[model samples]
Target: MDHMGADPDPDGRTAREQLKSERERDARRRRARRRFSVVGAVVVVAAVIGTVFALGGAAEDEAEGRPLVVPANTVGEQRTSVLYGKADARHTLSVVVDPRCAPCARMEAALGRAMRQLADKGAYRIEYRLATVEDDARGGKGSRWAVNALGAAANEGPEKFVRYLDAVLAGRSGREEWDGDALASPETLLGIAGRVDGLRTPAFDKAVRELTYLPWAKKVAAAHNQNGDEDALPAVTLDGSTVTVLGDDGVPVSPGEFIRQVRGDKG
Candidate 1:
């Protein structure tokens, strides 16, 4: 109509003004895309960093002559876990957890007995992969300390290790919050170990106090990251497949259902 078509967008702006507005809109969109990309990248990087430092990886774990040691009864080629059940159990149930995660403690409390019974029956071998993300998130060494305690417990024996885990993690459930500072004290773990018969010995006391298995704990924490769920605590997998043992709100399902899920019944 009027040579340049009535200001292009019909907003009454001049052609030049309309062009400038479109340019600005495009720039805003570009910035939004950049922000989304940065956010995605940040999430991945944060997970890696969190896992590393959670187990005291930020500090030197293996100093000059300090060698990496695996716990006595740990399984797998990497030997990064405390194993429960027969070595040739029909199924392998791997649990990824953090000592300070309330949900993790809750899950263990709710289903711990059932888990042990199954392991006793040779239904599955429970591989507990401990993570230390809480130490990084909460700004203390409690998670690392707890993991170290478990490592020492495993060295005593898998039975003792499993007993210690059942006692400590199960006991921590329903607490309002984890006292990282309090747990950082060696006495906390030592106190809990006292409940597990034969768990408290001079060797275990020395290991708990000096973090004898800290490097092994670090490796176990790192090994869990390979699962690629960002080390979400209280997560369970059966023979390498994830099982939904807990609801979205962190409440575990009925013990029967948990067993069924592990047995491959989703319905």
Candidate 2:
């Protein structure tokens, strides 16, 4: 009698394989989670430092219910990287964000909603300057994707930019991770650029190649991370002066109220 037992159930083999694969996958996931958690902790620490120093200025704004508006002239000819609306708005809001940072996405949504409201009311002259605060040294794929996407939108024009931003920010929570070609490819960035109407393919390709904002983005990170806080995204500056951090719970401050305050609206 053959001791091989006539080829034991295929189901058993399949189950064993599945179990082993699952264990390997689980281990990989665990390692990834650990890495992310470590990175998060470091970013959080940096954010705390930034928040503390930033509090000096922010506290003054809260105390006076007004912050000294730094003239755009002070920032000089350097156009801010994050412009939310048309270039010629009565008020310009400069924002800094990180793609993986949830709060920043919420702020983007709020700003979009606010702009839509204003547009519906025939008050669409608000300029938005969006900058990224991701440290290239630390941000991994998500940050790169965000930077590239932002550049893609800006190069294409605000309409496409806004649309794409809304899509990514809106759907960020469902995204599994920032790995693979989606975040890593220049072509992916260009594909996003292509979504913009009338974007010349050569220009888009050249823009990606040049990466004009790469340096500016680093500058932005340094400016925002002046005191080394890397914890928050969607740091907001109204009219190039006021800095508002998304509250601890991550709900954004009311965009309506912010606009009103910026406009000195009494009503």
Candidate 3:
């Protein structure tokens, strides 16, 4: 009868209870290990994504630090129709002209010297845009030759181009015969180029004779047409805004007054 306490669980109930508790503990540990593994995987994925974004951001920053470059379409082989000026200049003077336009010729004649002087003084940067408005209208035979010749001259150097332009405009005066047979003829243009020192190269001659730059001339004209009203042959813009030239007398000013106005020396 005293063996009652020792034999109370002779069926092994206490041992079974201890075994169940051990199994439950093992299950909890397994679940904890799985949770740690999931958390570690999530952290690794987040780090990878962060690294990718950081690299992308650095590339964008590098691009932003570079200097601005003009688009190629806006520039020609010899920088024809391209904006010309000091990079830090405060004002931009853009002149769109046609070789055969009488008004353009007159403007060039009147303002050529002043424009050159102002350009040399760094008063404002000047850009020349060529167009064939009259020539193209006259069956593409009027000023195409002259326009192409200008492009060829530009290929040599900007100085040479300016000299050649001055010569061309100077020739236009009192030459009522400048229309059909005389506009930049092979002999005429080469003669003009010859006057400018170092501009009458054999390559330049070949380009002019072969109309090598006619296509580019057409493009420049098209650009001019698209940028301004159709009737505005000699479209002039200051810093991309169209402006009118007026004299102190309240009348439309001549080219010289226009230059002075652009220089801020005249109203």
Candidate number achieving the greatest lDDT relative to the actual structure: 1
Residue-level lDDT of model 3, residues 1-267, one tens digit each, is 475546356665687787898899999999999999999999999999788557534533543354432222234344557444453567667777777666666666666666667666776777888777775565534465677788788777767777787777666554543655366456778887888999888888887766666666656666667766565456677777765542334344566566656756323
Which structure among the candidates has the greatest TM-score?
A: 1
Stretches of candidate 3 off by over 4 Å are 1-87, 175-181, 243-256, 265-267
TM-score of 1: 0.72
By summed lDDT, the worst window of 10 consecutive residues in model 3 runs over: 68-77
Rate residue 168 of model 2 by lDDT: 54
Q: Rank the candidates by TM-score, best first.
A: 1, 3, 2
- List model 1 lDDT by residue over 1-267, tens digit each: 368555565667887887799999999999999999999999999998687566444333442136776778888778887788898887888888887787888888888889889989898888888888877777877777788789999999988987888777755685434454456657878998999999999999988877777778777777766756574678788888887878988788889998888776423
Instruction: Give the total clashing residue pairs for model 1.
Output: 0
Sorted by lDDT (best first), the order is 1, 3, 2
The clash count for each model shown is: 0, 12, 0
Q: Which stretches of candidate 1 lie over 4 Å from their true place?
A: 1-65, 175-177, 265-267
